[model samples]
Target: MNQTPQAAIYSPVAQIDALMPDIAAPVDAADFPQTILRFRNDRAAASVGLDSLSDEAWIAHFGRFEPLPGTLPRPLALRYHGHQFRHYNPDIGDGRGFLFAQMRDSDGRLMDLGTKGSGQTPYSRFGDGRLTLKGGVREILATEMLEALGVNTSKTLSIIETGEALERNDEPSPTRGAAMVRLSHSHIRIGSFQRAAFLEDRALLEKLTDYALTHLYGEVPGDNPPAQLLGRVVERTADLAASYMVAGFVHGVLNSDNINVTGESFDYGPWRFTPLWDANFTAAYFDHQGLYAFGRQAEAIHWDVAQLAVSLRALVEAAPLIEQLERFPALYAQAMARRFCWRLGVVPGDGADAMIAAAVRGMAMSGTGIDRFFHDWRGGVAREGHDYDDAAWDAFRGAIAGFAGVEDARRHDYWTDAAPCSMHIEEVEAIWSAIDTDDDWAPLHAKVAAIRRMGAAHSECIAAA
Candidate 1:
């Protein structure tokens, strides 16, 4: 590694050493011959006091999987069993990824540095533990777009292209290889509890709950810490589902292991943004049953929360946990209405829920492109002479007229733009094709810049409000 300036190392994970055995299984990363840095999120790095580190240091820690100073000497491949499409699978764990390191962000919230495609672990069953370059690119796009839309999501911290030819059935054979590191609040999944429950290990279950309560739900107050933590997760998961709907995103995989305990969306696989307001839109081609379809996402999440509640039974009374689980539907509905109104640049008020429903109905009836409609109707006003023969459009116009105009000045400038930053399937393919065919990166860079601008405008709007 090239010598350069380094930041002061900090390790808060040592403070919670007792929780390690119950939640994580230690492992080593696969040794790759090359580590070419492809992407670095300086904005996210600054939050964790890592922006000052040199490129060489970044490649050493994130690419080659060197231990970060003051942190764990060996990486932890977390052990968790999850329900894949409602079927309990105890044979799953971190097959190709591991928890690389842990630290605190500027806000003093504990953050984790988790790797993807780093290497195989004992859980690597019938698969080569690797990640394609295309996969890394897609994750970068997913996180960027979701962040811009104001969703609570894990940020892609670093992506390094490992110079290795890998074969895969999903994409073309002998595809490019890469590794990724994500910055998230926590990696403790609902499956972590599920594993304990499956093993009938009540002690481990309670330990995991206590760890979560202290690390992820410090603000949650109550005599029953387990119930309190469950309540918070329920609320956060509801909001997350609402955000997906408003943003027109489909996660494709809603497996229990994919659902982070902190309720932040991570582990993007086969994810997509819907082209239109179709409730049945499915992201993954293999999801023949549409179990995690666009319209059914809220239901799926509620079911997952219920599963968590079942695991919490190891420590808490069934009645209290069930009460928290029951709050999901109403909380989701309120969140959807509020998020919908915010996207329309309106202050949520009386009849907001009805308006949201009507808007969805109209969009489905007219087959309106979701992103286009939002771009054209932002601020609850259509451009001059714009006309649509749809009930939803009419209802939206009438409802938006009752509220004060958007307070964010940045929004006005954003509205002047001709189109919104969108991540449709065809567009994603085109971006990737450019990289594959001609080694071009301009388009990808341009898209990220546009998305960041939109995010800044939205942030200004929220702050002003």
Candidate 2:
């Protein structure tokens, strides 16, 4: 990694070249007469060697949609088909967004600079390609909270208020507008392969598999490249599902296109963190069928993985693909147990699964705030003021007795805080309401600062361990 004196370590690279029709349907940025710098993620920029750029330069590249030097001059509106709520939708691609640029991070992993609500593209079917300022704020909160909770998720790199008022049926009309950029491991989704399979493009599918294996799954070794890629993705998807469960997150939409190939969670739309443990708690208002409910998230992701397997059949043997598919249940169970224990601040041991089950049932039955419970019971010890009179509490107490200490010493300071960091809907609305009413950004900035503090604490724990 070469680092210039002022610039962060960034190596401009175009790893997604094999996918033909590479140039995104060119669309100009919204002609916003005013561009206000709302947020900039310097930490993320440093990771990709863009921290050296001035705020004016940052706004120029991200806000004004100027091309990053030594990167793709034209953004690529990646083409893919997806299954929306188990119904195959062929008219889906980068409807309101595009892959803006590609570069290598300090660790040499390929990273993507993708946009949301920049402007309309060829795929923007009869819709204005603009993002609400409130929506951008919600995404910033979502990604921050998820990262603090240890989920592999996309980071909101930059947010620029495009200075436009937009009308919407869901929220108050004439809401403020903005554009956002997300930094993530990869933008390739399961739908990427689904599109290839749908077209019966055997050669394109093969090329995509090769590109994915080289850039995203290089460590996956096997004679059959498709099978190897499938296996690795299955493992990652399982881990991702468990992470969402532990984080108490409801992604609202688990469609194939929203499911990333690297297993990292991205695209925050109508997402919510659970207020309590209810299996059927749905995030999206239109999800009346509860297809992607909180309780059904693991199941939903497993179904998406099966769709990916169906797509992979065009490039590999069905037997091997099915063999990889069969491993999902066990993989999910193992990941759940491991991640659940990590959140509870205990080492996994005998009866770990039982403990996890008891905790979940207890929280659901008692309607205990999930985040509060974990914070109160850090190190397997109930805090001094909290009561534990119920049978479930008794079971939980006994379960932790056989385990070791918390994951890291750094977490102790966080536990000392009066309340655990939480992002329930009302709280999120409060943050946004302040901004909307008085143009006061204090609440929003404070919430972000607090969340970053929590993230720094977790990062320290991982680093020390």
- Give the worst 10-residue stretch by lDDT in candidate 2: 1-10
Best candidate according to lDDT? 2
Error of 1 at 83 (Å): 0.4
Each model's lDDT comes to 0.83, 0.83
Model 2 TM-score relative to the real fold: 0.95
Error of 2 at 99 (Å): 0.9
List pairs with backbone clashes in candidate 2: 8-49, 24-77
> For residues 1-465, could you state the per-residue lDDT of candidate 2 as single tens digits?
001113347798877776756323545666676789989888778889988889899888888888887887777788888999999998888877888889887778889999998888888898898899999999999988998888889989998998889999999989999999999999999998898899898888887788788887766545898888888889999999998998899999999999998999999999999989888999999999999999999999989989999998987779999999899989988888777766666666778788888888778767788898887877677878887778767677777788776557335477788788999999999999998998888998899888877666554443211
lDDT of 1 by residue, 1-465 (tens): 001113433434643465767677888888898999988988788778888779999999999888888877889888899999999999999998998888887767888899899988888897678898899989999999998887889999999999889999888878888999999999889999999998999888877877788877766445997798899899999999999999999999998888988899999989999988888999999999999999989999889988899898988789999899999999998888777767777666788777777777768877777877777777666765556645647766676667654665335477677777799989899989998889788898888888887776666665222
> Where in model 1 is the C-alpha error above 4 Å?
1-12, 389-392, 409-412, 463-465
Summed backbone clashes in each candidate are: 0, 2
Q: Please provide the root mean square deviation of candidate 2 (C-alpha atoms, Å).
A: 2.9
- Candidate 2 residue spans exceeding 4 A from truth: 1-8, 22-27, 407-411, 462-465
TM-scores for all predictions: 0.95, 0.95
